[model samples]
Target: MRVLIVEDHEELAHTVAAGLRREGMAVDVALDGHTGLERASVNDYDVVVLDRDLPGLHGDEVCGRLAAGDRPARVLMLTAAGTIDDRVSGLGIGADDYLPKPFAFAELVARIRALARRTRPALPPVLVHGGLRLDPSTRVATRDGHRLMLSPKEFAVLELLLSARGAVVSAEQLLERGWDEFADPFTQTVKVTVSRLRRKLGDPPLIETVPQAGYRI
Candidate 1:
């Protein structure tokens, strides 16, 4: 899933971003509300981890703006205040969920995943197409019941393609959703990863390249 974390605490923001990345999630960080708003506006994010207290725009305003827009991201509001009023206000402003500060990392991950799931059409717990089956929650991929060993990148790529449900996914879309912000768009990383992933899936060549139009399952 792709997430945007809007927090002013530099260390905390980067730390959270790193953890999410290690969990095979695409993450982008904004140290202030304006940058966060700008980033969220341009990108298609499954969830926005927004800090309620922010500089240069206030988190409330940012949340309101996003909530009013069409196809806005699922907002998970974060605040130091743990009061019921605070959470209610956050939710009132269109945050889909609320997380108080000093929260457990595991809970945060779980909530993010839960929110991400709501952003798209509900799919079966195990994504199945032809002979391939991917259990996202367990991080397992099996082809004809044979477990496939895949790198994090390869796994992310495959998961995305399977989630696409045979729809074509552009290289740009793959890079944005599967890779971090630092990925060089001009580089051949997407192509390279797709090639490697295809070899592992083997057999019927399920991933089809559409000439200059990117790829589809």
Candidate 2:
């Protein structure tokens, strides 16, 4: 999943971004609310980690604007104020969930996962197709009990295809979900990565190319 983190706290933001990246999620960071809103508006993010108090615009405004905008990404409001009123106000303003400061990383991850589950119609974390099994959490792909090594981007593409299970996924959909906003969709990067992934997967041809469409597992 791709996530946009809008937080002014440098250390905390880096920590959260790093943790999410380790979990095999693509993450982008914005230090202020305006940039956060802009990034959230342009990108296809699974979730947005927005701070309630921001420099350019308040988190509530950001959430409201996102909900009113063309592309609405799920918002997870974060603030130092831990009160029932604060949580209610954040949610009332269109935030999907609220997480107070100094919170446990596990809980934060869980909340993000929950929001992601609700926003994106994906298969369970573990996706299976015949003898192929993919563990998203561990970023591991196994075929017939043998572990497969894959690059981050390659793994992401395979995960997207496997999640769809046999249905064809369009290139636009793969670019939106498998890669970040800056990725060049028109380029051959996706094809190259898929080629490499196929080589790694070896026989049986797990990934089925859909010509102009995309790929299916």
TM-score of each: 0.93, 0.86
Candidate models: Cα lDDT each:
0.88, 0.84
Over 1-217, each residue of candidate 1 has an lDDT whose tens digit, in order, gives 7889999999999999998887778899999999998998888888899999998899999999999987548999999999999999999999999999999998899888778767457656678898899876667899999999998889889988888888889999999888867889898999999999999999889899998788989
Model 2, poorest ten-residue lDDT window?
Answer: 116-125
**Which model scores highest in lDDT?**
1
Local error of candidate 2 at residue 191 (angstroms): 1.8
Kindly provide the TM-score of model 1 when superposed on the true structure, using C-alpha atoms.
0.93
**On residues 122-183, what C-alpha lDDT tens digit does candidate 2 reach at each position?**
44767888888888666789989999998888888888787676899887887788776677
Clashing pairs in 2: none
Q: RMSD for each model, in Å, please?
A: 1.6, 2.3
